[model samples]
Target chain A: MDLIESYKEDLRLIRRFGTGFWIVLLLIGLILLPWFAREYWVYVVTLIFIYSIGIQGQNILIGYTGQISFGQAGFLAIGAFTYGHLSLLGSPILVNLFFSGLMAGIFGILVGFPSLRLKGPYLAIVTLGFGIAVYQVFVNSEILSGGRMGLTIQKLQPLFGLSQMTTYYYFNFILVFLFTLLSYNLISSFVGRAFIAIRDNDIAAEAMGVSLTRYKLLSFAISSFYTGVQGGLYALLMGYLEPNMFTFLETITIFVAVIIGGLASVEGSILGAAFVVMVPQVFSNTKAFIPVIYGVTILIILIFEPLGLSGRWMKIRLYLRMWPFR
Target chain B: MPLLEIKDISISFGGIMALSGISLQVQEEKIIAVIGPNGSGKTTLFNCLTGIYHPNEGEIHLNGENILRLSPDAIAELGIARTFQNLRLFMNMNVLDNLLVGRHLHFRKNPLLPMLRIRKEEILHRKIIEEIIDFLDLQAYRKARVADCPYGVQKRVELGRALALEPKLLLLDEPISGLTSEEKEEAAYRINEIRGRFQMTILLVEHDLRIASRLADSMVAFYYGQKIAQGTPEEVQRNPEVIRAYLGDD
Candidate 1:
């Protein structure tokens, strides 16, 4: 009985701390996995990190501010290309990634400024148009985008002095950590509150002295900037760039990731990114109808778990421990 | 000097005229109420004064300068604050933070400064924080979320948020309309105390004749977007146009 009571109390601590506890535990497991799990899982893990960066950007715009952008894949393409092209020209990896992210953000600002005047579906259409335009440019521009042939990037000079699969995993993990922290800090701050305020009521936000147009435009631009930077990192990790890599469906995935992970949540982005990137890859070897299976699974999750898997887990944990109170 | 003056202001929403030519003035440290029947453009006139709507004709001078062209944000910076007819509290935010946001014009810290203000201006003791919390009696429920509060509390909280701006002129849209008798009385007490405490030049739009007469020093009555009467509460209440236009009977 004493041992069982101790065991239950330990489980309770883990349940209460929830996402942070799980993420930290997962990070530890991931850091150790490269030693035992071999090459393929490492690749899949790297993919998860890269996807989280994309989701992080989406989280900023869609989750926090309640703005939808169909141009997300376009922003992703900009990051990938900027990084791939700069790296090809003999620039260092860090310099290329930083500049690429910066350029993508500026691009976001330009597009966001004029089109943001229209709300909701109109704004989504404008961003979709931007995606289509970028797609056209990517297909036609042989010199810049390498046309349909795609650009094969052989190497990226690592984030720090670290190397090998384990090092790469840690590096990507840290990047994801930083992204989550930045997002958390942003949400907790006046700017984040302002975004929620704007989302809640634009008229009231303005009456309360928030500049609606300015902040709306800035939120889009900033969200894109974060996504763009992630794109550059992604190109480096994949060791290639292709027009097909960023599709409209992928933009949908960005939204799906947040919604499924738990919209307006940092941990939700990570969980969504992981599920989106991993589940498909894990079944990729099955070859015949693996992608179809993944799609069905996602639909099931959407139907029954509107708050997403993370939200469901949170409720279950609460139910188990504090049942009567709940 | 008069705190606010609206000259022959007019607004047409597409083909329909919402507010026809209307004019009114509010003196410093006085409670001036605007009473009207529904669709008489009471809210429209308030919207124009607060820069939510731009009048097609004439100008509104705030503190002796035309504020007709100013945006809502610009009007706020010029020391004008307002409460919506429907409460628009940042429901997710804590009660104190809602008021703190109203002190936006005073905040030079940008968004970054609020984090640093605790250390940077250790001496300021967060002046607005202390004063607003005290003035509105929001001390007990400072940390409570606005969404969870009762309606009467939310109403008071909205007023507290507006007063946080420490504005020279406050445009209150029916501050006591939907409240029960007790709540209305509480709001009336706060209105009197606020006026006495802050020396605020209040422009109140209300439908309740009793509350208006008891609280307001003067009243401006509107009919079909036009000012029909303006004088002391008793004088305007006596005006036949006001009686027929807003009072409907008696």
Candidate 2:
């Protein structure tokens, strides 16, 4: 009985302290990373953070609610443009970020109307078309895209006591952390439960009093908000805005991150974003094989761990904890 | 006034009439069992009443308010809850989570609270879920995913979910057709208990005569999308049309 009680306590401890401990340790690692790593590596890590934020939004849509959007880059473009214009106008960085997300979220609500009546491949087509259309509109607009010559802010304000790169990196990190916490909260709440119910069996969800149109649009708006914020961060990091940045392939990369990370798992988005962002660096010398390597890695992940890296990580952790006994 | 009144409700699929001019009136706090053979329009009637299908003609009234044009969730919000014939529990979610979805209508819209880990409303609602779990004897299996649970457990979870709505009326679609004898008895007991405890009306669809006769306050029989007979259990069970539909003329 005493042994059983001790085992139970151990399980409780693991449940309570496990996530917080890892998060703190990871934060420490990230803070120390730039000090030891080169400038290029710091830039790559910043990109990873931005991508992770976008992928978290994708996870909410595709993973939690089982909705698909192939035009995520459309929202991202809207965010990036909003941020670029606001920053050029000498607005505070925080205000720029907030409005960037606000603009993208409004667009998300517009797109969400079609999603109410569409599903599967039909929805995917609409989103795909939407992404390309936004890209074309931005590319052709002289004021927005600077007539294909692109736009740039003369200077970006950095937080005091930090270098430009360091400030941006930390800013991205802070936003990622805040948004991850937000996603976790939403997932465990009534709104999140309703999304899963709609995903699993919509008729039952409706029968139980979940409004189909309301939640569908809500998920779209919320996910777009996250993507829009990430877009602002991306524009700030790049210091330049180009219509090409919001291409169809960009949206595909975000989708890949969500799938490879684990649909519906918050940590999966981070892992997937990191992998998509950094893996290209490893094959920088082998430009011809980049797509090949990317394809092969995704195929393997899908076959062996359909739930993505998060699922594999859980299995590994469980195995390590019960090692030799199992 | 009757708690629910279905008047001249008709529905068709590709010109094939599923329910043709069928009507029903359910009194407040009384159990009404709908018994019919397969393809006899029992589920179609429920679907029309719940807004899963729009009747080609006629009206549905809940407490004197016309609800035919309302969406399913809107109907549910106006104090209606239902279970499915095929056990439509969210297969990806655990039993507790499935039941939590049942409380969707009760939650105040606060999307940001859970992110901050606030639990004021969640804690309150969870207490209600706990009560439901105990009432359904789902304590042992609350953590189990519905996809992995046994059929009998899934059926109970579905019922528990509808109960969580705290609706004025409960629509149970074949609640005990697939259960073991013991499970059936348990379900029968719960049905009787629910009527007394909640003082809520029930529209039960059952193929089992024994369970229907034992539990229902009144019984209605249907044949080919039209009402054949309705009265006490004995009256319907002895009706020639219901007998011919079920047992066939020999």
Clashing pairs in 2: none
Best by TM-score: 2
True contacts kept of 2: 0.84
Q: What does the lDDT come to for candidate 1?
A: 0.78
lDDT of 2 by residue, A1-326 (tens): 12323322422312546676986898899989878888888989989989888899989999999988998999999999999999889889889999999999999988888998999889999989888999999988888877656879554556777778887788888888888878887887898898999899888899889999999998999889889998888888888999998888788788888889998899899999998888778878887776676678789989989999999998988898789877
- The candidates' DockQ values read 0.32, 0.62
Docking class of 2: medium
Error of 1 at B214 (Å): 1.6
Q: How do the residues B119-153 of candidate 2 rate in per-residue lDDT, one tens digit apiece?
A: 67876887898899999999989778899999999
Model 1: residues with Cα > 4 Å off, grouped in runs: A1-33, A157-163, A285-305, A320-325, B109-127, B130-145, B247-250
Clashes of 1: 0
> What tens-digit string does per-residue lDDT give for candidate 1 at A12-108?
3123445567768877887787778867788788878878877877887887777777888888889889988888888887788788778788888
Q: Which candidate gets the maximum DockQ versus the true structure?
A: 2
**Pairs in steric clash, model 1:** none
